[model samples]
Target: MSQDHSQDHSQDAGAALAEGRGRSAGARSSDQAPSLRPSLLDPLFAPARGLPGIGPKMAPMIERLLGTPERPARIIDLLFHLPQGGVARRLMGSISEAPPGEPVTVGVTVTGYRAPQAGPGKRPYRVLVEDPTGDITLVFFGMPAPRVEKMLPLGSHRYVTGRIDLWDGHRQMVHPSRIVDEAGFAALPAVEPVYGATEGLTSRAISKLAHAALDRLPVLPEWQDPAWLRQNGLPAFAEALRAEHKPDGPPPPVATDGTVPATPARRRLAYDELLASQLALALTRARSRRGPGRQNAGDGGLLGRIEAALPFALTGAQTRALGEIRADLGSDRRMLRLLQGDVGSGKTAVALLAMASAVEAGRQAALMAPTEILARQHHDRLTAMAGPLRLRLLTGRDRAAERRATLSDLAEGQVDIVVGTHALFQESVAFRDLGLAVVDEQHRFGVHQRLALGAKGQAVDILVMTATPIPRTLALTFFGDMDVSVLDEKPAGRRPIATRLVSTDRLDEVVAGLGRALQAGEQVYWICPLVAESEYVDLAAAEDRFADLQAEFGAVVGLIHGKMPGPEKDAAMERFAAGDTRILVATTVVEVGVDVAQATIMVIEHAERFGLAQLHQLRGRVGRGAKASTCLLLYRGPLGQVARARLEMMRETEDGFRIAEEDLRLRGEGEVLGTRQSGLAAFRLARLESDGDLLEVARDDARLVVERDPALRSERGRALRVLLYLFERDAAIRLLGAG
Candidate 1:
């Protein structure tokens, strides 16, 4: 499956450099040193010094918006800051034609003025104007009467525009939005672009800055295919940008424009961004292919042992995914694959199978989890499953002597499988013959961390797993570099969790149901939205709920919030798992990787406050065993339309992939990825919801381009490099060791 494309790349790079040298010589002879403009992508693009009117005071605000100080402001950033809406101005030659009771423009002559009652707290000036067809009043609440009179004296012709109403069947325009004379009217645009503003910023300021930045837009060669441009009826890049920044009216959907379909200018901008993304992914994929990988074929002995020890047989989907992983591990090419399965879909089992393969091959394998609890859970499960095969746990919480012994055994290749959190990647932990690295909850870790774990072995095969079933559109965009194995089927023995929606007002009823369930020897998870009640407002808190439930249910109710000490939290979880606690009141700390087969009832308080994926994950905590399960999504009264829809969607299906798509549609990509620090790409131009088709196109284009020119030595590729730098995907560039 591996190709030798690097040879072609090396030859092409040599030819490109030779041609560039000849051009450099010609430029020198012509007395031109060929502007070393840093490819318009140097770190300088981020320094506030490059932008006009961005003083020290404004720099901080820009930094706050961008969430970074290294990149301050740039001409391209401003151009990409798309407008949110547009304000269309109504134009009428005369007030006679202006429709009453609607926003209209009227040409009037100022005739008289009325001053507000002259007091400290009184309204200020009111000016009266009469047009040839009607009369209107302009009221300024704060302006001085003398100043207002001077500005619009008698017989002053002006075009006043605002909402007009009829009082006693007479046309009246209150608080005119614009008071423009003939000359001023000529300068006013019929339509104005309205941009989102921050605390100290105004839409006017944003428009001015955008205009200034647009002026600096360099006339570059078009990068899009001409055939695409003609067939799509898209304007040139510059024209599209101009239309977007100074839209005549509210910008139409991408379908109306024919180019990119999110926003007019943004869609064009997204195309460029997607091009850069694809280019970088292609380049990185190309470079990874260059790194020689070992074929670690393994005997089926250890795998058979682990599978035979399992209580249930593997589902068809799990078997298929495990087969895919085995095939990948046996291949000469490196195994950079993603294992995507729904929560409780037995992704961990698939990962275990893969790890067992490495172990059967006389090599070591390591599994990394995002959290200590998850790591410990994996360790416990793997230790039980790998008993016949022999595995070790190297978590941070392990005793010093035990950890030391485990490290020694790991270094000596005595440990078949090592399960831990990030402790596995620490310098102290060494694997004698590491063949595979399996990472759980892959999104929690960054690419660098993943790479560090992979680099632990001599080009180890990597199997990254995620319980969050990402929408296909986002999967291709984010995980395009890796082979994807989707576990779409749930195990046959798994029962559907009966989902119920309840209003928070019926808490007593829900609590009564929980009491009944607990009395019946069924375990319950009483999840809250927040860990603690805020002083400013009262909200259901996990601690408070634990206290309330403990009073009623006695010592059987346990609390496990993030704020608790690690040992205390682990104790609480242990109590719940061992059935010592019938009720576990907790926060989102148990959102992912916490598996309790006996917990059959889940009560999510203020479920509307949770995202669809989170709700799905919380619900997954139940229905693990054969017994029927129930999920009570207890939401507060008066849910917003979106929250209501989310609750309904959750109640309708247990399919994680469908829920994920709905979550994307409801919460958008930014919120879906969580806060800015999640290392998720916050695309300024591309909307994952709207531009999904473009994402698909970009992914395919990237794969195709890489197949054709792995090193980006082609002419089109040089231009694409500019795109990568522009979109901040330059991290992929460094993978080539080129820059």
Candidate 2:
């Protein structure tokens, strides 16, 4: 669908003006007339000033609590802010009848008073209250005496509510939360809603502010299907919000009371977020599908040569993945597929086959890596694999004359397969007939960079490869715009890595074992925790370890870290690969793209500090060789419960897919995807850990919805537009231009 450029320009202008309104509060000229208007989301997203009781003082606190720098908080954020638990204020009539350590409300009479030591540094005030059955002391430390006297005077009847505690055999309330007179006490809620509070902000303040904000909530049209709502026993949007914001004592179940059960309100909000994400992904997919693309069905001659050159036969999973890629490239629609495999799972070979197919079709193909080292690695591997087929490498580190020669060859169709870093997208680089673009470690590249590579050719088919095994739900959320294929099995001759957990306290023992392994001519990787030693603290550094190991093992040991020059790192890697360096002490820089088939032993120092996924990736480094590899997880003693469980899980299985699921369970989706910038969705209410089941439902529902309303022009689609806007997914709606 082609967007109306003029309307988009107008909308952009309106959004700018609406944003400017926050800075230029004094500028008001009704006669000037508003040429363009902000959407409903504009007002809903306006600063806290737009909400009642959210004055300048409270807005900053709200921002801090929400962890956002955006001036105003969105209404959707408030709706999704579900309570963790609740406090009950149900009345028990008398202090004696109230359960100990439980919150209760009671009507009592002020029978006496005891003033504490007055003046500076004094406790100040205390009040004595009595019911027909019992008397409870109210202690107020550091409170003004006059205020306490005025509020709870002698013989005054009042209702008091708070936690009842026994102090030195005396029943006392540290602070009587409510000490209202007869008339004022009648107006107090029998059951009050408690909210999460920040410093200088009490629960009562939040409740008051939330109630005021709810009052200003505009009635929105139903965005969920009526039948679905009825089947799920969910209330309307406003009703659900109201129900969730108000709770009775003892907290309700997650279903009904809105505080505990899977309340309709929480489900509604979760579904809204899911729908917005799905809609955006679907729209992006649709736009890409509409773009012009070429069908490049390559001859199988070059692919045959590459297959013959392989040391071992391709696994069934690898073959299936290659077939999928070939089918996608052969189709008219541009391929945007994610090739996910575990470390050493043969993703590189699969990528090479796909590129060979493109080359055989008389079209150019480019493989882009995340870093210069990885790019150089890929270049070397591809050059060897496609040497008989004549592939070329172009990287940033290339000499000036060499780069010119490579670019000219690329422009003149002398290069069939080009491998490089992001430099592949530079203007000087041109493809003779670029058909496919393969990106390694897809998470490292942004959407714009990936699109730029695709833009280098007219409808270049995109194939992204990642060593990280993404959970199914996150795959749908993050890479929903693309098709996905998993390389589930290792190729023939691949060995399973034997993982072991060891205490770091036995450093001497580990070093002795490494010495024996090195004597046997077995390659070793002595991974260190830090790149360098600090003055304030001591930790093993890769360089320091390299020197120490060299003193014992002679020149057989080498060091590599991020601080080393690229050429130096590459040389170190080459020496290790060529069996010259028996021991390579390095940082986590070798975690991802570094591949050495002979390295059999892997040691990770301070393994407790690494996440499950990182641990899995690091373990993968040693298992590539035919000799049975062992991953020694050198953890510090006294491991925490979670860390112990993570290490045990790693030792239990070598399944990357299962490890990915456990990682998601232990470390949430946010951390599992690396940083927030990994393009993982930031959920407001739904949690991938607790809400894993909901993700499947949401994914299916989203796919079904898009299938029915591709353009999102139906009534349900219109309602979904409100959902998109509500979740601040208006960008997805704008893509459709449905309005």
Candidate 3:
């Protein structure tokens, strides 16, 4: 670690981290401004290797910590590396009371020196230093004896900082971290920002480099509202960075539960990043889906007939969602709406009704699923609820003649709706006048793919669905560009699932329970984490469990996994769905949109291995029908704190939204299943778990800014443009009157 000799110029170093932006300039710039890079930012973007103190040997190590192959470590990138926390340079009165493993600054008198052997192995040049309480040995390795003597002449006074070690039954400090006179000790920072240092490079070195980087920063225009800053008691961008890097006082306090208070500077920087992201999304939404939309609303003929034939009435949430969709469909602006519903919330029904409206408008609609089984399930479910609307199924595995027939019928407008996987995106698949496109589990597809599907027809409205219930903060963070419609309520009479957490020591008892469940004529879903047995992970496998269950229950058991052939997988699922097989042992391949209301029992092996959202989804497979269902979470014992918390949570509640929020609290955003893959901006400075409250303010500010200055010609509008480019949201700036 670099010894902290002084804290002269580190104000801007930590400030640079306020906007944790990406590396590299974009491939193109806006024509309206022509030159995207202002001359002020050029120095900040200079390579780290070119910095004052960084040399050839240490440059690669810095790059390894910060840079990727696409971009070398730059001065700005070093600033992005924020300190983890502060370490106080505690001063001690005497050696007797000094903690053995803690850093303490102490005054001592150098007494005498003992030299190593002439030509040697492992012997050090040991010097004796004495305080009033006692004397200690300070050993220096691989140093010239004459130099060591000259540095510390007989009876010289000095201040030493570093830990004291109990080496060979004596108090010795090997190479005291810093040995300086009274002046250097006085210059030391009270609290040092602790960087996450790697081998060779120290936090001290990083701090100095950040200080150097900050010197290049020019006074920039403020993009935030002055009133909001004062109300929140937050600092400006530069002031925040300075406060973070230049640590003079004791560190900020952390809560008892390990929550760090968002110090004004940290909050300021986080708000900066959030505002940039929100503004970019607002600009894109303004330029794209706000244009004149196709009028795809029908006369409500098909929807009325379908509702009349329905077994149960739609929930209020579903009704409200449908109203929103209808309003978007009827408006002159194209619809780009996100439908977030918990498991078994009747989103499928709402989507079908939306599609039916398009059919009534004499325009065709298409639904795309992430998997073929899900597509088939949709086709089956929609066919039952579609009433007079014509529908066709398309897949890559279809026979040549039948596939051609389906395509020809679709192009000739013979089909009202087509359900398919990615095959529907093929060049050969043509639609007569595709009006509305519905994408299920949009996390599996990128935003560009969703738009590409909409591009197949003129002004095609897009409605994306997700079975995973995302917390509101994540919904805004990921789907901020689209209008949101939430199906918050379940259909009436939806069965409540009884979730049971059982230990694996009760294997025989669980099997016995399974036998009882089977004798009751209820179907079961047994989920495993792996497809095959492996010597590495000792978790249960679908194939082994399938064989064991099949032997015990005869031909009533079916097996399926991701590795199975498409047709074989289909057959296995069909057998289980049709009740030909009472039990299906499969991997998480069945986690998505494979709906079977008849299956009322879910047995997940190694439940601790799965996340909260996955466990909730697997449980959802059972509680869809009227009969009270049960979800058995089979886990092995000796659980970690997180695992035990997960199990207790699974047993406590089945509310998917509550479970989703808790999941984020437990495993954070990255490990919370499919959330991070939603094709949104990956945040470097702001974490969704803590900074979520600021997101709404940023979003509102962005919307108002876009409303007032659509072309970004005003002074603050131009500054907002810089914010967009700094955060690598350049696409939004390009949409700003490029011609």
Candidate 4:
């Protein structure tokens, strides 16, 4: 989420712009009538033009860089856009003791100038200057000789700050970044904050905008619990913002770099943000609960039919999880729940049973998968388990007749269960009565997508399932609004996967072993990281390996990658499933939701390049069968510390939850599930790794605040509403509607 925060801020600006455009001034004022401080924060939320130093030309550029592509930039965007780092600008009188490669400010006299010769090649324009200690050259490229001479006339004094360089046994400064006279030097600070700026938007310009934003900050009330604040010694909201924007000196030596540190001031600001986020999720949950939902209870007839048909008995964890889902379905409130289970933990079985319950209630149920292949896989398995119940698969690949038939069945209440990809949410795929909507790979979809699915049927119960085991802290961060059910136990007779580490240097020996394994009538999965040859990345490709193995093993090898056509990929998988292809070479497309029961051996090439969670998932592929399975982690030599630790942990244990916690610690939250790709919330101020402790307190405080004043008309609630808007979570306020 840290990476998405910038994009989110931009979108927020765009939404604010659209909102401003649609409403008249009178309407805007009228909208603020619910609050006692009517439009008090409007000054802060106003457009960039409200800032003193920002002109019209710079406003669009600032908004382009600062705001999201959809909206205009505002004063609040500038406020949250904190500094990246600072440039220490200590004044120095001499340069003799100034070290090379370090920035130094020195005053010098303009002794002489050497202009580039007007010839075929463009040379540098050099200015010779001398200070009290020594003489140095200031080299400038692409500058006119007249301009150089005018700025540095003989005997004139100027101050400059730049990296001192020694080139060809001569002290030279290549294009000083900053140059000023005595009066300009006097105005410069000893340490200047550096900001993320575009070509037209400079750091100085952002700094000015930030200063203007700070000037307009309204004195905010303390929204935090007083005891918690006293215990933490946190500063007031306005005081924290001021201290962060205007540090007394250079920032302390902390990993915060140029961004706000976890100082009392910065932590206070972070708590405010966390509180706002939690409050928004809570409000959304509350608003959804306000809608009346139909109670679709089951008599256990359909569930018994499916479970009795199963060969193996249900695990205790599965029973508990099913009980939770059944309770949610029986209740009048809509079920917005998360079904979290690791790979091969029987999550699909539980989902099938839940859908069976929906069928027993005489309502249609739909299971949405992230991919076409996964949707088909779910359809195939559930169809087999469902016996007499009608199960249909819908995907984009369905031909006209097939698609028309499925749509007619769905809309006519003829289909009891339908499983498909995102096509389920399309406008044409109307259901007679969609009681339960089960979403697989929950993180892959966004919040609005869930809402859209819910809108298809009146108060549709949503049960999102995720194979990737998220840490407890991260689960709350991503799915705080929903009740969570964990399938901790694997099914009976499930064998523990024997994980082993091997180097790629022993390719011949490994091939010989694979030959033996194939001769023994066992299936093997050779996982590659890439599809085709990429010059930029030195990773093994599945196509090349498939070709290599085809020559050696002859038609026993099959390749499946993301670049392959949908039918080809499905064909390759089908051949592998039918034992026509004993060796399957694939990419990470096989990392999630792919279940191969006959597969007994797993080979992950360049395992060092994969994260801990992915390595765990890939390993889970082999242990599904009844036979004893082995996972060989093949890596090149010279593994990094993190990679070595990751592989070692995989070998040590197969606990998905533990691996997830370690993955969060090793890669941070951004790279684990991918902040942008998975739609994970990217926090701007608070870090999940270090700021996890604060999250619980923030959640509790937000709940208490909402509990006391659900309408948020109280004075403190008004201040908290401003906090929400500042964090781009004003949607929570709008959910309350005029109160």
Q: Deviation in angstroms for 69 in model 2?
A: 3.4
Q: TM-score for model 1?
A: 0.84
Worst 10 residues of 3 by lDDT: 6-15
Choose 2 or 3, whichever is better by TM-score.
Answer: 3
Which wins on lDDT, candidate 1 or candidate 4?
Answer: 4
Instruction: Output the lDDT of residue 151, model 2.
Output: 84
TM-score of each: 0.84, 0.81, 0.84, 0.79
Cα error of candidate 2 at position 399, Å = 2.0
Clashing pairs in 3: 15-241, 293-332
Candidate 4 regions with alpha-carbon error over 4 angstroms: 1-5, 9-68, 72-74, 84-209, 218-228, 255-261, 500-513, 634-644, 678-681
Candidate 2 versus the native: TM-score? 0.81
User: Candidate 2 residues 1-739, lDDT tens each?
Assistant: 1110101111111011112322222212354333122354444444444567777787766655543432334443454565654555556857788877765778889988897864667574778888879888999876787888888888888888777899999999987656677787667664575556666565666667666667667767677778988998767877767766775435553332123445567676666666666666676677677777788667788788889888778899999999999999888888889999988788999998998888888888999998887888888877777746667777778999999999999889888888888899988888888989999987777666777888888889989998998888778766777889999997777788888899978988998999899877799988887888877756677778888889988999988998999889889988989999989999988889788888999999888888888888888888776688999999987998779989999999989989999988777776775744343334656665665666667667777877788777788877777776565454555557632
Flag clash pairs in model 1: 46-72, 254-261
Give the TM-score ranking, best first.
1, 3, 2, 4
lDDT of 4 by residue, 577-656 (tens): 99999999999888888888999999999999888989988898888878999999999989977899999999998889
How displaced is residue 470 in candidate 3, in Å? 1.2
Looking at candidate 4, the ten consecutive residues that score lowest on lDDT are 9-18
User: What RMSD does each model have against the real structure?
Assistant: 8.0, 7.2, 6.8, 5.9
**Tens digit of lDDT per residue, candidate 1, span 39-125?**
554332434334677677776655454323222345555676776655455567677776665456667889887767756675647
